[model samples]
Target: MFPSKDAPLKIGAFCSIAGQVRFMCSGQHPTDSATSFPIYSRLLKQPEPVANGGKPAGITVGNDVWIGNGAMILPGVEIGDGAVVGAGAVVTKNVPPYAVVGGSPARLIRYRFSEDVILQLLAIQWWRWDDEKIKREAAALTGPIETFIERHSVAGTATK
Candidate 1:
C-alpha cells in the first residue's frame, strides 16, 4: 500500500507515475554462470550482476509510460518513454523509447513513434505537465490514443 504524504516514504509515486521512471536496485538478477547457481536461496539473496560487471543497476521507466498490472520488472532493465508493458509481463531487458513490449522476458513489439518524433516527445516531457492541466485533458488524454497522439505528438510525427 502507498503511504500518506506525511508518512516516511518507501514506495515513490503510487499513482500513475510518469517521466524518466526507474525501479529500485533490488529488482535485477544475474544471467552469467559465475554468479548464477542452481541453489535457490543464494540466487534469491544475491542481486544479479549486469553483463558488464558486478555493480547493481536500476530499472528505468520513461515518461508517459504504462506498465500493466502485475508486471515484474527486473533489475537493470530500462523501459523507455511512452512504452507500454502488458499486464503480467516479466521484463528482463532495456526497452527502446516508445516501444510496446509484452510476454515473458518481454520483447519489443513495435516502436510507439518515429525516431524524430520520439526525440521531440522526450524533449517535451509532457508527463511533467501540471496535475490540473492533465486532469483537464483527461478525456483527451485517455481518448483514442492514436488520435490523441496525432494531435499532441511532437511536430513531424507519423503513426506507430
Candidate 2:
C-alpha cells in the first residue's frame, strides 16, 4: 500500500486475506534501468524509478477472494472474484475469476467450480446479499453447490 495517487489498491467486499499478504504496487526499483537501484532517484529527491516502465499501477482484489499467507500480489495485478491465492505465491499477472492459483509467478492450479456453475454463481452474486437474507439462506449457502445453486438460483434465494 505505497502512496501513489495513480496506483490505488482496491480490495472488494468479503475478501479473506491472511496474515502477511502483501498488496504492493508502488515504490519499486525499475528492472529496465541500468541498475535495479533507486540511488539516483533518491539522491535527486525525485520520484523513485518503478516497474511497468516507471508507470506504477494499481492492484485489484475482487469479492470473495482468498489470499493466503505471505502471498505477494505484484503491481497492476487484478485478482478476480472468488479467486484463491495459495500460500507464498508471487502473483505477477491478472488472475481470472474463480481461478485457484499457486507458486511463484502464480500459475493456475484449478477453478473452484465448473464453468457453468461459476457463471451461475457470478450471476447470483451472493456476496451482495443482505445479512438477514444470508442468515436465512445459511443452510443452502453452506451446502453442496448443486443444492445451493438450485435453491438460490431457481428458487431465488442465494449462493455461498
Candidate 3:
C-alpha cells in the first residue's frame, strides 16, 4: 500500500494488465487485534494514525510486465521487468525480472530466458525505446530471440 505520497505504486512502460487482475494495495488492519472495527473510526476521525500504521509497502511493476487475467497481485509485491504472471495466479511475493510465475502465491515457474539472455535484455531495456524506434524494430520484436538480440544489441543498449 502506498501510504506515503513519495512511494507511489510504479507501473513501468509496456505493461499488460489483463482484465480482472486485482491489486491489493493496503493492509493496515492487524490480524491479532480483537476486532477490525476500531480502525474505521480512526480513519474517519483522525487520518494520520491509520495512515502511518502497519500498512503494507507499495507495489512496483517494472517495464514490459504481463499480468494475466484474474491474477491477484498482493500488497508490497514488486513485479520485475519482462515477468509473466499466469492467469489465476495469486501473487504474494516479489517476482524476479524475466521470470515466469504461476500458481497460488505465485511460485517461479522458470526464467523467460537464460541468465545471459536475461542480463542482456536487462541491459538493453528495450521497453524504454521511443515510439519511432519501437516501430522501426517491429520485425525484431516479433521474431526469435537470437534475431531480436542480433538486430537490437548495440553497445549493450537496445536502441537504434
Q: What's each prediction's clash count? A: 7, 0, 0
Give the alpha carbon lDDT tens digit for every residue of 22-136 in model 1: 3434522336556544233254454333443443345556666687776766655666777888776777787787798888978888887667666666655667788897898
Best by TM-score: 2
Residue-by-residue lDDT tens digits, candidate 3, 13-91: 9999999987766544655556655464366643324343444556889999999999988767899999999999998
lDDT of the candidates, in the order given = 0.60, 0.83, 0.78
Per-residue alpha-carbon lDDT of candidate 2 for residues 47-128, written as tens digits (9 for 90 to 100):
5545334645788899999999999998779999999999999998999999999999899999999887887888888899
- Model 2 has an lDDT value of 0.83
- The reply for model 1, stretches above 4 Å from the true place, is 1-24, 27-55, 139-160
Candidate 2 stretches with Cα past 4 Å from truth are: 35-52, 154-160
TM-score, per-candidate, Cα-based: 0.58, 0.83, 0.80
Please give the distance, in angstroms, between residue 96's alpha carbon in candidate 1 and its true position after superposition: 1.4
User: In model 2, which range of ten residues has the least summed lDDT?
Assistant: 151-160
Q: lDDT: which is higher, 1 or 2? A: 2
Per-residue error (Å), model 1, residue 93: 0.7
